[model samples]
Target: MNHYNLSSDLELVSMLKDGDLTAFTEIHRRYYGVLYSHAYKRLPDSEEVKDILQELFICIWNNRETINIGSNLPAYLYTSVRNRILNIFKHQKIESDYITSFLHFAHQNEPLADEPFRIKELVAIVEAEVSLLPPQMRLIFEMSRNSYLSHQEIADKLNISSLTVRKQINNSLKILRVKLGTHFFMLFF
Candidate 1:
């Protein structure tokens, strides 16, 4: 029988600190699924969830020399995952606020027929701005917004991770926000 199979997390962690590859592999085998599931619950994007988990493990490995988990490894993992999720949410909120701000500006300043006309203009602006995105980001953005595909759907179709699909979409939005600036409100109100 493998002693590692019966070893406590603290023991495995100590071994990991000593640069034990087998111990690290064992830890990965033990917790990767649990961590992945936890991340998926908070983030619907599978690719993002995978990335988050992968990053967590990679961080652990890279920092193994200095890593310290005082007996509660599961809690440590959960906390790390939670923090990453919070950061992702914070970024999403910022992007959402940009959209909200644009809407408010349009509501306050634009008129009846002007609203529709402005929408058309905004569509044009978005198209032009989207064209400016890197090819992959633009493709993902269009797949999501124009083709109305879900992240998982896009990932499957593109043979990429859903996380990559989401990141590209977010990047595209950020670029649009910056390029369109206050003018976005004039286009989409």
Candidate 2:
């Protein structure tokens, strides 16, 4: 039997197209080193370089029937290797973009991690101060602010004039402002 190692590129390609495994193995042995060296120059990552070359060989085998290596198999192999490297770079870029976006999203929402607790604490402080208000003023303030009732609605419900409800709410606000000071409102608003 003739040794496949001595076969020409055209002969190997022909044998590969004819589904000869020995010819494909010989082609892999002949071209793998040059292709790997060429790929490693562009990508320093050893594993990635190996993966690209392995994929290149698999592509050759899988597409052997359709592949037409007319005269220059070396040129074809080099082009294939170069194309695969380009695709790896493209995929790496997309992955890098996704990771950047994810990190930005996490950074942007980081404040939210503390927000709920701060809101709860502020609400408790306000509630404690509200409890210190005289009974009627507290009731009216809760109705207007907490229940979202208008001045007219509070007045009508309490059998008081709209002006009294407005005045009482204003007084309650003044007292709370003096107690809680400005920082609470600044945070909430």
Candidate 3:
């Protein structure tokens, strides 16, 4: 395992603020496993673990704007993650999922073997439309929809702040709404 890096968090964070994705990715990769372990130790079930990690990273990035630190990154990340996890564990019951779209997909008839062509065509169309967006907006827009990852996961993977991810998605959806509003509204049936 790569050990906790000795590079000061201040310097690393400076690199992060400059839109350095590589530096940010490294920091996330280094700490993700440890942070998950910290969360899992406090929370029951492996399922909620992913969501907790997402929230933790999102919170960290959101708070990073005004934060300054001299502490080791690992200790700070681990303790912060643990305290957050314990807090959640103490307060909430894990409610059953009420969404049934997942069940709909699970029971749907399997597509024909070559039916993937339809997906490819749809992807091409979406990509073409997304490409017309402003640059950063375009990247975030597609990353949110094309990948199976959640918004926070996309933010972590792209090393952009989660706020940026949410903003981008909001912007993209609004544009899409304007472009397809009547069409979209007609689909509720």
Candidate 4:
């Protein structure tokens, strides 16, 4: 058996600071179980508890040349584990808050349950009003609105002047505005 296993924590810490691997190993062996139990009480996850302890030990080893535990190794280890557990809790809360905010925004932007039905009814009314227009005017309006054609394009297709196509589209709009009230017409057009 290694004699380091019986060394006092202060002696171990001094040896650890002097780059003695055996003292560091003894420190880990003596405190790992207590630290795991302490951290597991707060964190509850075995893997997370293990990782925190592992990282703590790695930090101690890497900074052994300048590590200052002031002769109380267990206090330092316990504090390190406690701080890591608190950080995990803080990160989880942030993620939870972000997810909750995203869900709230998504719910707010979702259409009302009857929105699709209302939209269909409005489209039917608009189509009925558009169909009532004079035949040539209806054709020009449908070309402009449905086919997304420009006035010049409609005029070229129908063998009419661009000015006549524009007038027909304007007249169609006026007729529809009179049939479907200004507020209702504006909703669709």
Best by TM-score: 1
Q: What C-alpha lDDT does candidate 1 achieve relative to the native structure?
A: 0.66
- Summarize candidate 4's per-residue lDDT along 1-189 as a digit string, tens digits: 224433677777898888887677657655565566556666688998899999999999999998778755655666677678778877784455446666898888865479556545534443445444454645543563335566787677667798987776566446545654644345435
In model 4, which runs have C-alpha deviations exceeding 4 angstroms? Answer: 94-189
1 versus 4: better TM-score goes to: 1
TM-score of 3: 0.41
For residues 43-134, could you state the per-residue lDDT of candidate 3 as single tens digits? 65687888877876776676665555334454456556656665765566665232244467668857446744654543344344444445
* TM-score of every candidate: 0.49, 0.47, 0.41, 0.48
The residue ranges of model 3 lying beyond 4 angstroms of the native Cα positions read: 1-10, 93-189
How many pairs of residues collide in each model? 2, 0, 0, 0
CA lDDT, every model vs. true structure: 0.66, 0.65, 0.55, 0.65
lDDT string, candidate 1, 1-189, tens digits: 135534667788999999886677667755665566556756788999988888999999999999777676766776787789878877884465445666898889755476446545533443444444455744543453335456798777667799987786666456644664774343435
Model 4 is weakest, by summed lDDT over 10 consecutive residues, at: 137-146
Best candidate per lDDT, number?
1
> Model 1, residue 127: what's the lDDT?
42
Q: What is the lDDT of candidate 4?
A: 0.65
Candidate 2 — which residues are off by over 4 angstroms? 94-189
Q: Which pairs of residues clash in candidate 1, taking residues 3 or more apart in a chain or in different chains?
A: 47-163, 48-163
| Span of 10 residues, lowest total lDDT, candidate 3 | 1-10
Q: List the residue pairs that clash in candidate 2.
A: none
